[model samples]
Target: MKDTQPADRGAAPTTPAPAVVTGKDAGRVAFAAFVGTALEWYDYFLFGTAAAIVFNTLYFTTFDPATATLAAFATFGVGFAARPIGAVVFGWLGDRIGRRPALLVTVVLIGVSTGLIGLLPGYASIGIAAPLLLVLLRLLQGTAVGGEWGGAVTLAVEHAPPGLRGRYAALPQVGSPVGTLLSSGAFALVLLLPKDDFESWGWRVPFLLAFPMMLVALYIRRRVEESPLFDELLKQDERAKIPALEVFRSAWRPLLVAMASALLGVGGFYLLTTFVISYGADTLGLSRGLMVNATLVAAVVEVGVILVVGRISERLGPGRVTLWGGLASAACAFPVFWLIDTRSPVAIVFSIAVGIAVLSVAYAVSGALLTELFPARLRYSGVALAYNLAGALTGFLPAAATALLKVSGNASWPVALLLVGLSLLTALGGFLGERMRVKDPVATG
Candidate 1:
């Protein structure tokens, strides 16, 4: 348990000293961050997967196939649209109150929203109401997860000793690929169901499973202590009254550049994971299971790469390695579509797996990199706003890609060009952020 006593500031109602945690306790806190992030993102990945493979036929049945697909992808992006709002609200809470409690709230909110999605009636049962309800729930999920990453990442990085901040922060980031793998693997198994049954109710299994997983995550999170850095701020009574505003006023440069870097990573990854499924299925006439399975294999590869990058960041510098990832993403953009065009499952899997691994290089240290971009006083708000701002931009990438592909008569050129463009921006942002990075004595900023 964390020390919550008020500090002795030489008067009545004095603020207490910061609670000190040992090295062993740091690992526990980081682990909690990892578990909660993984569970929340598991639901995130489930929605993305379902939107790509199943939601169109069920919720937008009234439209033609292409229109329905566009509608479904739009709905998938709606969650991202709500993320920045969540970042503002929760970023205030994290900066004002404490990182631990704020994170706990996000976990419960995401779990309830995701589980409810499993119970929603389809368009056949309720007409337009079905899609409306899905949009509402996806927005709620987006809000919850939008708040989740900053707090979790800050928790891990702040709790660790200064030297290993990258590795410890990366632990929570491992959740993204792990969640993607579980969601992908779960859907792949459910896809084995007969066609009629799959279209009917098979896809709900993963969403429903989120309830039990949330319980486990909540239990683990409860055991972790508050961030030592935040606690120190509390002791000094230096907590910002409006953390979001403070970040906007004092830290906008890092926030803007960081958002750009995150855009390439988030948008490019979604293009590969969510949009590729549709392109492979509709354009190439491939099996859904094959695309999902290939994603699963790539997800497995991504997990390893993220962990390795985290370790490597301890020596080579997080920002520099992440810049390499941006160049790699640009180089791989053409090949990603070219391999899928081949229509061979082997080539498709190889492309996605290798592409994701390169992307993981940036992702591996993203949490730490973002955390290090601002003063500890405003770290949570700064990073949360930057991260979710990127989410808001990229949330529509899949739908936009779908529309672009259709307009160009199903050509992959537009999508590849867009990715390369995003990657170039990411590289520029990475270079600027590294140059402008504030050097903190604790190495957390």
Candidate 2:
């Protein structure tokens, strides 16, 4: 049979399709997505903070002092190495049974794994086993995040009303900044403890905090119904039984575009947010608390600007906004680091905040745009793989940038060029994806 599906197999249905969200239900969907994603991101950002500040000293001290830090960062990146498996496993479940169940599983996995990290014995206590167990936990965390992002995005994008998809979709992206704020705040407080206590036991507080937050997120998620689009899909018998298999077979074009579209945005953010912490603390001799505060400020700006860009995308189209945002990111690439070099508190916050703002423009609209790349039957698998594929690489971004800096005699130019290149790639992929969407009538909604 001819492929009657949207171009690149990514566009919305050509027909009027199904309308699953009403006014009240729409808000509920977005809120549920936000809460769940916030929990996941809290876990993610917490680990990143720990890796940058404490993990090397605590868990990987077998290596030379400098090597321990790199090892710690490498372990952090290793977490992403497991995400592709997660995308496949959870993606299959989401496509088959339901999005809600799959997402529920992801949250539980992340919460349990994260909490256990608090209880794990450090290298001083457990020797080789310490880092070994830490690696295992990070792998689990990566998998959970791998599954969480795509399913959470669906909850908002698929439920959105026409002309409002941009803003509604952006709601889930809000969770990252919220997560960043909470994680940084938690660590900032922990740092206030006496040095011995903070080193010995205080670092565990943030990881333990996930347990309670997870319960709250779980309760809210359980109450929220599954995606309206998936329900319509069920009624139509269009759900793919082996969506992971089908997506690879029929959706490679859109999948390629999706991967490219997600790459720079995800990687650049990690380089900016996570790696910046290490660079500021270890290289620049900046106070850890000060860098954390700067990152917190950036997160705050990200939240506000993401909301605004979501609205702007409603009129200008996500592709245009996203492309421009990428250009904006390229522009800020060197400035952000230059501000850090100056080590001026006010300038640091402005630089990082502006950097995050530019990043969010593409991020805020990514869910809607990526979702449009696949038909509903296989969307879970398609989006999951696409997003986590980016995760697979992005997780290593900080380590890569760190190594580049070291190799270049601590020059920031290599890192800056990497940022600019990734931004341009994002622009190119988004522009092409947008063109495909516009050519397909059903995807316009």
Candidate 3:
């Protein structure tokens, strides 16, 4: 849907227009978004890493080894199932109240749930209740994260000068890699422990750290200014009464495009990292430590890719960069798995790093592209629903890969095919989204 001038809707403007944000304020907001998202993702990724390596044994001990791993992966997917609900709830809050308040609530929810996971008892200690509690906490995390990206992207992009929207949007996207680095690094360090100690308490250490990180994120997020566009909406009393409903009613096409644009970043990432970790360690007979370290290296590579690609997006446009990135990733899908199948430590790391780097080109620009797809009045709900819907649909990729591996007699080709399909879907999104982009009334800042 094309963006239109805000209608008066019979209410007279009450609040004076907010002062223009200085460059310094913009930088602060970007930093705050980065920090807040990084913390939230760190918590989320911790569960993924643990699901691959720890939870199968600890929480699903009643099942056989293979079934237990599948069960653990299922729990990981459970969080994704709850994300759309979070998106609707927080997206409404963001659209109705303010971006800053919605973000603050999300950070708190994610942090508390993650920390509680650290303290939770295992199946040995609590029987069936253990997995149940894990699922409940995961649902909370899903809800929090569902709300996190949209608000952060909306806030950052709204604050950016038109010419620099790509770079500003990429700043918060950096959090995914940063979060991966922190979570994977934490696991890498703790993996150095004896197997007994590592399984017993080491995994819990990283999760426990979420509490303090949340506090820091909260402090920073609270200080950041609200989105200028959202502020303008507030002054005009133009908030959508039911943003989720409105998005579906008038913005379904962009919503679908956004989901397609997001699938590879969400699905393909889990395939390359979370599922690959399980595949490498459990299936390929690779060292668990080696697999975790490979992801750590990939996380480092992704950070560089995002920074460089962000600047490139400013020149090439987000959609073109995203399209190119997706095509490249599709081309590399088979080779990535082939390299990992070699079972050499160097090859394993190289495979994951390269895979993530290519996919990251699209991911880095997604924030800018998604923001351009909807008007400020419905941006939060539309972006959150689209992105989180993709997340919910693909959250089961690791488990699906696990199942595919079994059905294919342990061949990696089926999984590679899955990545190729996801990449092409992403490419289609970038193509369509660019062609149908909504003009950003406030982007000129």
Candidate 4:
């Protein structure tokens, strides 16, 4: 159990009392963060998927196909570009104020931005301003997302029992699969509508629905206590005077490692989900609904792989699993492109499922792996900055890969080579990242 006694000014808070938060409290925190993140990402990814499949026709009708795609994805990248800024601003508040409050603010920001997108007038109704408005909203969404994960991960991991930190911390990451399920399900549900209606109104419904779920997430988050570790740090006056700066000066190496190692999971996953769906449909001529169904199967496989990989990390360590997952991605890249090109529904589903399964090894351990990268005072800042920047690097990956495919005319070959190159780099970094976890001082500190 953590020591609960408050420490003297400038001292780290005394560890909270043995309320080491074993069963129920731990579960509550994890569930709150996981569910909240699920809803948040559902809104965010829904937009990405929509941008990939629906936005060009809905908003950027004036540009040629290639140009429209670039514009659409650039807007999509806007959100990621906003993340590091959000992290610095929000991370300071979190370190200075508290995690729960930061979480509440981020969730509302995301919910409002996403819901507003549903109501925006398209290009047909309101020229030039349509895509411009979307880029603005995507920026807001990106900012909110920057703050969301740091708070969520801090809230869950800080309250977790000492030995089981990895398993408990893994809980929040479940949101990726959950959000993937809901977003794709909503897209699938609306696919039942006629093409005209689905494009006209159906897409809007999913974004709007995020509001009700956001309210629920807020209620759950409001009920949780601040991090016992952080509270103890505060009481002890051990807080860094400038945490974000401290992290940069003291722990830049780990931050870089975190960024590089993250590509195997986050970057890879986005390319697999949002970009692949767009590519399979637009370039390969697969039906929108069928492509969505294939993504759904992959999402299910992802959820299962997430759970299994989390367990595997507890035993073999995240770095090892992540290394292997990257290797798997490298090996599977050609096969994935081959399956997509086959145009057979079964082939598409099988390929996507295989890709996600490989990526899940990295996904399952990412939160915990990142958390281990820095000390408590700078953990949020360090993790948030690294995570968001990695996001920024690959933020445009889908768009870039799609364009590369279009330009090369051999879509499968170019895309496969790109994935393999990235996977190998990510795997090499993960292998080196193994050293970062040796006696994780962050949780204990």
Candidate 5:
């Protein structure tokens, strides 16, 4: 597709001419994006929860407590490392063919990988082969996830009315917290089982549920129309020959801004939920249920935050909302840790919930901000690469935080500092993103 800049410089650069979608069509598209994303993330987050609570013992049984946990987390990080690979592959397909086809493939890939995880043998039965298979499946999950958010965000944003893109885009972002709630809730229920059963069979139920969830997501996704912008591109015969390469060659700056903006949402989330859950249970001697419950509550809070912020961003602008949210999260970093350090259940829950809420403010508008960074022809590749590259970089945060905790003699300072750094990076990205959209014709185009 010929890359064209918006003619009206006074208007919001990302706001294209309104698509012809009716209110019902827009809602259906947004809902489809939300459902498919939620299911994909459910599969993804289940692994994080399992790494903290189950994989260390079952898959890395030969190691010491600390080493085993680290190993499990390493495997958890492996999925993240594979995300960019998926991004490239699916991004290419989305840009070359259509967003709907790429999304259908990703959902199936994630569901199958996640369901197989439920059926796989652990180290007890399969020895080293168990962890190897676990890593392989995690890679597939990561790859699927890498392609998921970009397509979901692009489809929703492209389908939205000019002024309502933020709200429509935010709908897909809501899937993150929904996935968290479902995954954590499933784990909480399974945790109530007898110890042996919970370890052997109970833990697998959540992963197994992916089969049915996948079918539902697929059905919904199949009903949604292709992105209106992609349809325009098709009619115009404007598809990029190599979308990923084009992004790197011409849109590298926006890609960087997107990655920086996306880091806290990806990394900060893992730090709060995955790392904190392990820290609470293992280091502070808190009950696992307490930790999981805290995340469940936080997930609920995040859903509200995302919806509220999405609406606000439509007025204030997504970049400004992201900047404000990032700054707020940075300011809360120390207090969040201080509260967690108190070893009180109420304090822990409050800390986690409040932290997630603030971070979610930036996260909620990410789809709108990112989609605006690239023209429609390269939107999938650009958005997918930016978001998943950030995922690849920060996917190891939980494992890194665990090591930092041990290195700092269990002090929370290092971890808090890490949060501060990530929040600041996001703030910078938001600041630059808004300015770029205004001043850089390439990005706006």
Candidate 6:
């Protein structure tokens, strides 16, 4: 008998026009992707907050406090370092199999690893093995998240109509704040327990809670179809066999520009969201509840700013808006420290909220701009590699900057200003990227 059955590779790709995704279709897809990304980030930010607050004690307490904290942050950076690997591996699968399937696997991996952390025995319970397991699990979580952002953004952008792609894709990007809000809120709530109660048991509750949420994300994702763009690529027989290498060979310049651009607000994101929480508690003598509350305020403000800046990009263009926003972020870095130093609760809240708002301009435009940088064959691989590399560079920044502050005799203002200077460089890269030619028929080279 002749071989009649189609290959068992995966589901048939669907091809929908990128510029014709109706408002209703875009809304449904974007919402699903948004929730999915939000859930992914929730696991990540939750761990970041925990690492800053408790991991050193729970996993590394045997060493001197400074060494323990440094070790904890080193482990934290390890996850970021693992991201590019995930991007390459998962990006290939996404380009080969489809976006939905690749993302489904990533979300589950992250949820499982995060939930398992809650059940891990601490150093006292398991001796030296405890921290080792924590580091291993963290690497898993990092790898999973490294895959999440690229796939989520691809889904939203590929499904969006051309004119509104910038705004449509931004919905999922905004989910970062929604995730941050939930993660910070959970941590803050848990902090209300007595110190002994918290250290003994309460810390696990927030992580355990991520399981049910993950199930919900999985269900929502399953109902969504693959991107129409990928489908069209299949119909045209345009799939690249080796996407990662192709991206490096063909789209290297855009990839570099995208990486530098990504470094802008993400560094600010860690500083305001992760570092500041620890700083408030340890350096400023703020209560745990108060510090977390300030972070929550920032998250809420972050979501709002995402909406405003995303819409603004639709009008002014992603490049111009992001450039201006980056400059504004650089300008405010010094005053942000001043606000925090006031030792007033209101000042702390204002500082974080303002910082998030300024960062939104760059954050809102990034997904769409990066997605538009390459042909669809290498889109997943190209965008994922660039995005993850930038994240890896900046992932440990908060911890490093904090250490610098201490080493420099608490020269808080200058250290903070140095972060702003980095933001200026990010802005410059993004501006250059904006001048590149817009690729036509985005699904094929």
Question: Each prediction's Cα RMSD?
Answer: 4.3, 3.3, 2.3, 3.4, 4.3, 5.2
TM-score for each of the candidates: 0.94, 0.94, 0.96, 0.93, 0.95, 0.93
| 133 Cα displacement, candidate 4 (Å) | 0.9
Better of 2 and 6 by TM-score: 2
Task: Estimate the lDDT of model 5.
Answer: 0.91
* Candidate 6 total steric clashes: 4
Cα lDDT of model 4 by residue, 1-445, tens digit: 1222222335545432223344558888898999889988898888888988889888999999867877788788888899988888788878777778888899999999999999999999999899889999999999999988877887787777766666766778888888988999999999899999988998899999988989998898888888876776667565666667877876788888888778767778878888888887888888888888888898888887877777778778777877888888899989888888888889889999998888777767877778776666677787788888888888888788878877888457887787787788778667877777523223333
lDDT of 3 by residue, 1-445 (tens): 4454233345443432442544657778988999999998999999999999999999998899889999999999999999999999999999999999999999999999999999999999989999999999999999999999999988998888767888889999999999999999999999999999988898899999999999999998989888887887787777888899989987899899999999999999999999999999999998889998998999999998998898898888888887998999999999999999999899989999999999998999999999888887889999999999999999999999999999998899999999999999999999988886766553232
lDDT of 1 by residue, 262-369 (tens): 877688889999999988998789999999998899989988988888988878777787788889889998988898889999999999998888877888878878
Q: For candidate 4, report its TM-score.
A: 0.93
Per residue, candidate 2 scores C-alpha lDDT tens digits across 1-445 of 1124432245454432454466667788888999999999999889899999999899988787678888888999987888888899999888778899998999999999999999999988879999999999999999998889889887777777767878888888899999999999999999999989998999999999989998999999998888777776666555666787777887888888888788766888888888988888888888899888988998999899889988888898777777887888888899888887897878877888888788778887888778778776677889889888888877888888888978998888889899898888888778877865522122323
Show where candidate 6 strays beyond 4 Å.
Answer: 1-20, 440-445
Per-residue C-alpha lDDT of model 6 across residues 253-353, encoded as one tens digit per residue: 88898887788766678877777777777777787677778888888887878887788777777777778888988988889888988879999889888
Q: Evaluate candidate 2 by giving its C-alpha RMSD to the native, one decimal.
A: 3.3
Put down candidate 5 lDDT per residue, 1-445, tens digits, no spaces.
2355322234222333323554558888999999999999899999999999999999999999999999999999999999999999999999889999999999999999999999999999989999999999999999999999999998998778667888999999999999999999999999999999999899999999999999999999999889877876676666777788878977899999999999999999999999999999999999999999999999999999999899999898889988998999999999999999999999999999999999999999999899887888789999999999999999999999999988999999999999999999999999988766521111112
Candidate that would win on TM-score: 3
lDDT of each: 0.86, 0.83, 0.91, 0.80, 0.91, 0.81
lDDT of 1: 0.86
Question: What is candidate 5's TM-score against the reference?
Answer: 0.95
Worst 10 residues of 2 by lDDT: 436-445
In terms of TM-score, how similar is model 6 to the real structure? Answer: 0.93
Clashing pairs in 5: 1-238
